[model samples]
Target chain A: MSNITNQSLSEILESIKSKKISSLELTQAYIKNIENAKKLNAFVTTTFDQALENAKKFDNKPNNEQLLSGVPLAVKDLFCTENVKTMAGSNILNNFVPSYESTVTKNLWNNGAFLLGKLNCDEFAMGSSNETSFFGNVINPIGDHLVPGGSSGGSSSALAADLTPATIGTDTGGSIRQPASFTGTVGLKPTYGLCSRWGIVAFASSLDQAGPMTKTVNDCSIMLEAMSGFDEKDSTSINKKKETYSKNLKDNIKGLKIGIPKEYRVDNMPKEIDELWEKGKKILKDLGAQLIDISLPHTKYALPTYYIVAPAEASSNLARYDGVRYGYRSQKGKDLIEMYENTRSEGFGDEVKRRILIGTYVLSSGYYDAYYLKAQKVRQLIKKDFDDSFTKVDAILTPSTPSSAFKIGEKTNDPVSMYLNDIFTVPVNLAGLPALSLPAGLDKQGYPLGLQLIGKALDEQKILNIGYAFEKNCGYKNEIKKWWS
Target chain B: MSLDKEKIKHVAKLARISVDEAKVDSLTKDLNSIFKFIEQLNELNTDKVEPLTSILNQSLRSRKDEISDGKIREKILKNSPKKNEEFFVVPKVIE
Candidate 1:
């Protein structure tokens, strides 16, 4: 059953279809695993009875043909799940339950995917580590002491710990990829507008994208097929035809051109990561793909530009949480102003408050031109860098994160250090490109390292195909940490 | 680009959040440091550079100005802290 740790969605569904495993029994098994793995803190809430009831309904249906029928999956807390407490890892939303479901979650339910429960995340999906969550930090199931990357930390950790077969996570700036890298799992951030943002608790309107996190790239393809579609509710949702993402998994990659970004080979990168990247390039080369040198010279500006743009939009999006509206409101306030102040002050965590402050300052009247406008211009250059590079190569490659997972509390105090963690992954978000982080190898400390593949806008299929090719060639499956097993 | 204590307090107020006086000092220092780092952007010659808003330069699609169907008033008001029979209640704003 431990080999069930990384089963693809199709395999799991086949077992259920043949009556080899009952949906109730499968959900029960996952529930049992989650119960025993409580130390990992992978789940914020688990709806066992609800999930079982839903599974029983599916069991009775004789003619259901949904692709993800009876598959149990966890949702990141950022998406609004109707009637469930969808707190985006903050005290402010502690009591908030949406009356309507987020489009992504609703689509998943429509496809017959069982909703296990919501997972933990950083407050408003702001931090790179799970430590900022109001529900308490999630521990990496692979190792007890290492931090699970965030704001999708719980989703990644839950999948890694085998609490769920697959999970859905949203990425804006490296939320999905960074944590996926840390947990040695497959995480995909699809092109912007590929998934609707109507009910997603907005972090940054322009950058937020919902994607899948699973144990294998094949599972990611299956989950992505179910999660993505056009929605009239979201103005930015692209009206593109849908296709099976895993249809071309067996496609050949011979004569494929993979771009290796020169700028990502910065002087400050750790030596082990550099060597692993070289090894990854060689593996691709030996697998009949050609490596082409590319340049994204504006790479150094990605972190600064992202910080300014994301926070500015976050400040605006979070303004909806004033005391009068839905969410936690202060009980002992004398007046409306005091109520507003007290509610937000007590509800939001430190990191959220810090971002809100920075956001407000940058978008303020006098500083808007100096900071926000400048960052916007730099954003154009960053996108241009990718545009120019894509003209030369099919996809761009770089180390997902500069280093492996850092110890908890290592860079929490220094905000700059924390922001640097997303340096390589942010540019892709800026350009609205599709990127996937696949485990390449392990660092000296035995911590997992990830190599990122970035494709052009709306080219998610290509990135997944490339990731599939790499997975086949590498055949690299390290043993899950003893604790997870 | 140095943010003083007063500027930090003002920014916090503008953001509608409260900050402790002691914490304000550290926030000022941190904001100043970040701003100084961002000052590197000033070195690039961007006189003719246009600010990019969206990744694709395509224009936003416009729908006809017609009333459609969406009025979840009850659902929207369900989570409000203070609400009346048909509307959300709040403290008086005007004297």
Candidate 2:
């Protein structure tokens, strides 16, 4: 019971069901852990009182009854939590609270998951590093002075620190998987419409998707089952039956064709990351899986295409945040137009402004065809690359990031360098595919290096099955020593 | 495309965001650098590819237009920074 915080979500459920530990006790343990890990800045808000209340309500319930009964889970600030401040890590929404819950979180709560609180993220889910958050960057619990890769940084750091049994994160251009990789956690970005985007603050509507970040692949599967479904509120939500991912988690991957995309190899990628990719191939190969070399020619254009499409959508989506409606407003303006300008200039962070400007410039009268339209057409090519590759393989394997986590301020000065962290991840979003990153090995600095498994559209089961096999055989350990304490 | 200060100012105006006079030069430099980086997309020949606006290519699912859920105007307006009685307050533009 003392080591309850270290248990996986499935183990916790088992413990609760056997009457070995009450739900309230587990909730208190996580609350204590979160209170002690403040220096990590993993949480923007901790709903401790409500968590205890919910745990008390489920203290006597049979755990086997509900999907995630009494599971203490954290939500990324990007998701609206009905009465809780749902800032998408921006000053503009610093005081904004939603009166409705996001469909994803609502699904979790309906399945009996208790709320641990809101986690930090990049402003409007913009940056690769958590440095763009207005509340400040979340520190990687694994090392001193390193950043937990972002937008979902707080969720990853909290899970790695054992402050929450599991957490939810939104992925747009690699927010969930990248942070999970940086923090030695497992994250799965389901197919674009697998989970509804109803109350999740929009980043790039086309790319924004919610997924599970957990300590194990098994937990990720169960959480995904509880979190995904077709919602009528979200127009883009796919009208399909929810997947029971846990039921399909098989350890055997015999004859499964895994594609190793040659385009994923970029210049100056750390030798350790490449070695981990090789190790992943060998592991799958030994598991009776055939490894095949494949090509995704439009892969290199993913980042630029993403930058264009994401910002253009972001510019349009974020235009609703005028001073009059909600959130922050500026009083310095002499007229209505000035007020709109002043409020936005003061409310948004530098990176956000930069992106909005890029979006505006691309969608401008003279440049629409060259930048926006060109990027959209290239996006089609990127998706075609995946569609062609998936025809030849069951799933694709690659390094999650070029390098492991670096110092907090290392790449802040260079915007393009920061954008490069998502090079290996953005293509999946572009194609609207499900992908997951599991810890495969540690780098030279002892930070976790993750191996990504990319699956075809609506084919998360294949990737999860492959991940289950890898998790069983990879021998990669992610247990931490509470360094943040 | 070189993003000089004037172009930066124009974009900012289009975006309805005010930039500090002192920061415009730095913003211009930043925009130019990012544009240069994105210029690599021009290297590829995409002659006949159609723009992919949606990933699913699934037809839009429309519902009969009606009030699916509402009657929460009080709750919705609760977060407004400046509100009077029933409407959000903003600086007068007509005057």
Candidate 3:
């Protein structure tokens, strides 16, 4: 069971397809792992019974042609799963079950993947650490006290702990990649319009993208193919023909130019991370790729600009949570306005409230031009910086996080400290480009460190191909002892 | 440019998320720090720069005006905290 559970998504699918193991066996193994690893708090809602039923159905009628046939996936709780409690790690929607399915998850199911459970995330996918989750913080499976980088901490932890084969998570800022880096997994933030955002809980609508988190880059490619497609429901969704990423994956880059952005070297960066970046550059060089030193001059402004843009969009998106249609409501209110105020006040976590306030202040009458408008204009300069760099290189490389995973409560209180975690990753989001973080090396303390590969807009294949080749030769593997279990 | 307690309270009210009176000072402090950090954007001059309203710079794909989705009234009213016969039930608005 452990061997079956520990296999990557591609490997698991191979075994399932060859009839070496039934879907029921695979799903049961994952369920056992999920049940045993309850201390990690990686799961917000475990659909074990439903998962077992789905596995039985898949087994009862085998569909070997499906991309993820009988492969049970536990996604970040932000995706709206029909009839399942999709809370998006907030109390406001704790009991809200959607009748309709999110296009991404629907596409996953259509491709023969079924639900395992709902993984935990930061409240409204806002916080950098999972500490802000209404359910509770997800402990890093690598070490109990260490924090799993968030807001997709649970997806990363569960993937690392073998609770799920390969999972999908929403990356707004560094949600997917940072958690994956902390847990020594691979996470990709596909181009913004590549994956439809019709049903995922909106944090920053423009920055939010659903991507794969997996133990191997091959599995990430397989899962990304399963989750992405064009949907009329999502107006921002790209109408490009569906890309066959896995089938067309190419790693033979004799002279492909990969960018090494100089601006990513921030002040006080740990020596080990700097060393890891050098190590990553060596791996790409070893893979017959040319490294060019380039600059994204506006990189420093990414974090500040994100704080304004994300919250401004968040305030507007979350306005739908008013006590009228759905979700948790306060019973203490007398009037309609009071009901809305009280419901939101009581329902949301402190981090959420702070963001809403920040968002409102920025988008308010007098401050709109000063904050929101200025941030948008700066956003253009940031995008232009990437555009200039992409002209010189096919992809860029940088350290995933400033340092390895910190303790759970280390930076929870300090907003700026937490925001700084995404400094290396947020620039990609601001520019709405595709980027992936793959584990390249470990720090002195044996915690995994990641290196990012940023590609031009709608060029996920190029990044994934580079990542696949890198993963094959990186030599860095997850030595995470199953201490939590 | 610092936000006082009164300003924090006012912003929270405008956002429709009630902040406790006692917590206003701390909230104000946090907002001010965030604001201070955001002040870095002001260092760059954008006199002729256009705001990036779109990422892909593609126009929104519009559909026909005809209703493409609907008729699931029970589903629409299912998650409501309080619901009447067909519509969501909220506190009375008019006297």
Highest DockQ against the true fold, candidate:
3
Cand. 3 TM to true fold? 0.99
- Candidate-wise lDDT, in order: 0.86, 0.91, 0.91
Q: Please, what are the lDDT tens digits per residue for candidate 3 over residues A1-485?
A: 45898788898999999999999999888888888899999999988889889999999999999899988999999999999999999999999999878999999999999999999999999877799999999999889999899999999999999999999999989899999999999999999999999999898898999999999988888888989989888989999899888898887867899999899998999999999999889988998999999988889999999999999999999999997798899997789989889999999998999888999899999999999999999999999999998889999999999989999899988888999999998998999999999999888888989999999998899999999899888888897788766
Off by over 4 Å in 1: A1-6, A62-64, A482-485
Off by over 4 Å in 2: A60-63
Better of 1 and 3 by lDDT: 3
Q: On a 0 to 100 scale, what is the lDDT of residue A373 in model 1?
A: 94
Task: Report the lDDT tens digits of candidate 1 across residue range A1-485.
Answer: 44453566678877888887778778888888888888888788778889989888878883348868887788999999888889999999988988979999888888888789889999999999999999999988667888899889999888887888888999999999999999888899999999989899999999999999987888888889889999988888888799788765654778889999888987788999899899889888887889999888888888888888998999999998887868888785667777777788888988898888889999998899988999999989989888988888888778999989888888888888888899899999988888999988888888888999999888888889888888887776756754743
lDDT of candidate 2 at residue A221, scale 0 to 100: 95
On lDDT, the stronger of 1 and 2 is 2
Q: TM-score of model 2's chain A, to 2 decimals?
A: 0.99
Clashing pairs in 2: none
Candidate 3 iRMSD, 1 decimal: 0.8
* Model 1 complex DockQ against the native: 0.64
Q: Which ten residues in a row have the lowest lDDT in candidate 1 chain A?
A: A1-10
